[model samples]
Target: MSKDVWVIIEHQDGAPKKISLELLGRARELAETLGGTVVAFVPGAGVSNVAESLGSRGADIVYAADHALLQPYTADAYAQAVSQALQAEQPTLVLVGSTAQGRDYAPRVAARLGAGIVTDCASLEVADGHLVATRPMYTRKTIGTVVFSSGGIRIAVVLPAVYSVPPAEAGRRAEIRAFQVALDSKGVRTQVREVRAIQRETVPLTEADVIVSGGRGLKGPENFALLDALAKALGAAVGSSRPPVDSGWVSHDYEIGQTGKTVSPQVYLACGISGAPQHLAGMSGAKYIVAINKDSNAPIFQLADLGIVGDLFEIVPKLTEAIRQAKGRA
Candidate 1:
């Protein structure tokens, strides 16, 4: 098909990023429904080797733009290359992962193409032949939906963990084509001197499907280990309420609330949490919620799909062991 959907591929240390693969998986379904082709577009140096990997995730073709200076991820280089691709290919929709690099570059590409753009989108659909995107608004307390009615190319940046990963097909092969876009001699003004990776959890918070979070009710900073152990047993990420973060019991990065990162995991196990409005704003969108608290009257129970009234100290370990045994049997 001539009309195509483009998924931007992001890679680091010669490995594809998780969020990009998620987009490709969802893009594949959309492409099939719309009777269009799925294209994976990669712009960086020495990226030709990743074409097959992209194809396995549902890309029919790989449009690779490799250049020496493009490896460092300058906004100017990526924007120019993607804009050039849109002009040459005229894709029906552009999908990008809402990551650090994407947050910077997607807007530039949108401005360059004069396309209607949406950021931090959590879901996508095609209705009435128009690309529509849904995103969290008002600090994630409300959902906002947008449709591209400009009759121009559509661009959207999807958030992490919004879609499940697609199974890989090792034998799949995609058509590879080298896309060329000459960079202006003075266009890229900034230089990336170095990139130092931060120490991250096994599963990043936003990318986690299941999360075990603690709050002020835990009583002590050291008690976080209880949730940590439970999280490890379930292969989940550990998160926190603002009180623990403010008390220095956990890092601010683990905090989930109005002032913290937004999460929409498949299952959110809130341990010793009171379900304050600020905290609810972040995780209320979870697909299923299980609240464990000593107080049966805790407000969190209102939003929880399942509620367990008891001391988390005694309950968490038992639950962890059950899950461990279940996994072992499986």
Candidate 2:
């Protein structure tokens, strides 16, 4: 019987991605409840150190595939490697982060293995020795629980920042298995020509404890400078709604909505944003929400813990100044 739980580890520049560790934590819990072992799969160039770290984060085994062909993310290569590994180990459930890379590769891997694939899962549970996944539907107004009956294995692509990372334990031992790579040069349709990583001053939106988001109500793209100033003063990350992203005012990576990143920060400050259901679905898990908008009837106010009715242009600057003073940085 398929019994082990496997989490695919994602990394860049030799450092593990935060969501990969979070997956390990959640997988560990599920494995414990199901009386199974938790394993991790890391595919890249020279990723043994990353595999070691996964062991410290509750993985019973680490499958490392370090090869030149696996240097950059290619859907075919990843699918081939993971599919082969799954055939060898026969894990009952496999978890992947719902990031862009996983969004592309998870379905391919599931198809190759003839398994069930559930995307953008917000919650996971083990019921009747099967993995049941829950994801939002109807623009986040409702949730649907999916139970896989594929028999071979179940796969889930989890949203980032929805789950917390487990504590790392030092000196944890894991069986490290070196997997062989099977690359089909003919099947590799796309080649990565270049990789340009964005260097920004603020923390990543998915990892930030506090987030300050804005929308079309800011009026213009240049006005985002004020939003940045407030975010810097509050030591928070800046996020945007779909309108801003669709308007090309901000990069898609900075967008927080059903179509973008899902963040559950300790505090979410929405300024000049009309809370479309899509945007709220991404940030509703925030511990506290504060909305600042000129229209008192904005949908955002309904979900906010504190709602301020005023012109954001006039209010944001004063709020930024006040926060700076409170921090003694004025």
Candidate 3:
């Protein structure tokens, strides 16, 4: 009777993505509340180990779809595999991380399965036997809670870093089932020629506990070195506004805004950024926000826990030095 919650896991280079575990934690909580089992769906080659890891986090069962054609992420292939799994398992709810891959895969799977899908949900809970999904709309100016009907099944794509990763339990056991699907490459438009990974330190913005972001206030790309140094001192990931990304000063992956990654880090430091509504929509979930800008009237200061009205050029270097000195004491 569709009594279990299923999660789709994403992996690269044989390693599971961090957001998958975070979604597992959320799914576990929901399953406990609804008195249902938490199941994980892993797709790709040699992913049985990753399926086991999902059990350690909280999955009650692991469904592994191992195929050579599934080695690389293709919308058609993944949708087909997940659709088959859903049809067989009859899960009441399906959860996926709203990462780049999930964004591409979840909708396709939902469309194929004829299931209702809610994307970029910040929070989820079961209310009166219905899954309630909370998501931002109108550029984060408004929040809406959606309740799906008792239709086929409910599927939700959640933003990364909105929830914490649950602790893994040693020696946890899950029933592992291997599944197979037929792939027809007919009419496939896109082909993967090569993949190049970006080298960076600290965690991904969505998974990072702390993020140090800069905006147009830094003046130009050359000044980003100061921001990077400060972020290093704080052991935080670096994020940028749309201007920096559009100017080619920073990679598009590092951009944080409405069209970019939505981060809920514990601490978000905005330097020289004006805090437009679009940008704030992505970072409003941060536990604490610190703004450093010369414009005291900047909208960013309205949401900041700590506001510094000064030239970022002068303030950033001093702050970096102070953090270095403080670290020395530790």
Best by TM-score: 3
lDDT per model, in order?
0.87, 0.88, 0.87
Q: Which portions of model 2 show Cα errors greater than 4 Å?
A: 328-330
Q: Write the per-residue lDDT of candidate 2 for residues 1-330, one digit (tens) a residue.
A: 567899999998677899998999999898888778998999988997888777788889888988777878899888888888887888888999988789999999988888888998989997886678888877678889988766878889998877898888888878998888777767778899999887778989988889999999998789999999999999999999998889989888889988888887989999999999989888887889999999999999989999999999999999999999999954
| lDDT (Cα, tens digit) per residue for candidate 3, span 162-240 | 7888888989888998877666666344677788888887678887899999998887889889989998999999998
Tens digit of lDDT per residue, candidate 1, span 1-330? 146889989987676788888999998999987788999999899886676578778889998888887978898888888888887788888899877789899999998878879998989998888788898887666789888887667888998778888999888878999988787748887888998765755588877889999999899899998988899999999999999999999888898877786787999999999998889978887899999999989999999999999989999999999999999999
TM-score, one value per model:
0.88, 0.93, 0.96
Instruction: lDDT for model 1, please.
Output: 0.87
| Candidate 1 regions with alpha-carbon error over 4 angstroms | 184-186, 257-259, 328-330
In candidate 2 the C-alpha lDDT for residue 168 amounts to: 86
Candidate 2, which ten residues in sequence have the lowest lDDT sum? 179-188
Winning candidate number (lDDT): 2
Q: Give the TM-score of candidate 3.
A: 0.96
Worst 10 residues of 1 by lDDT: 195-204
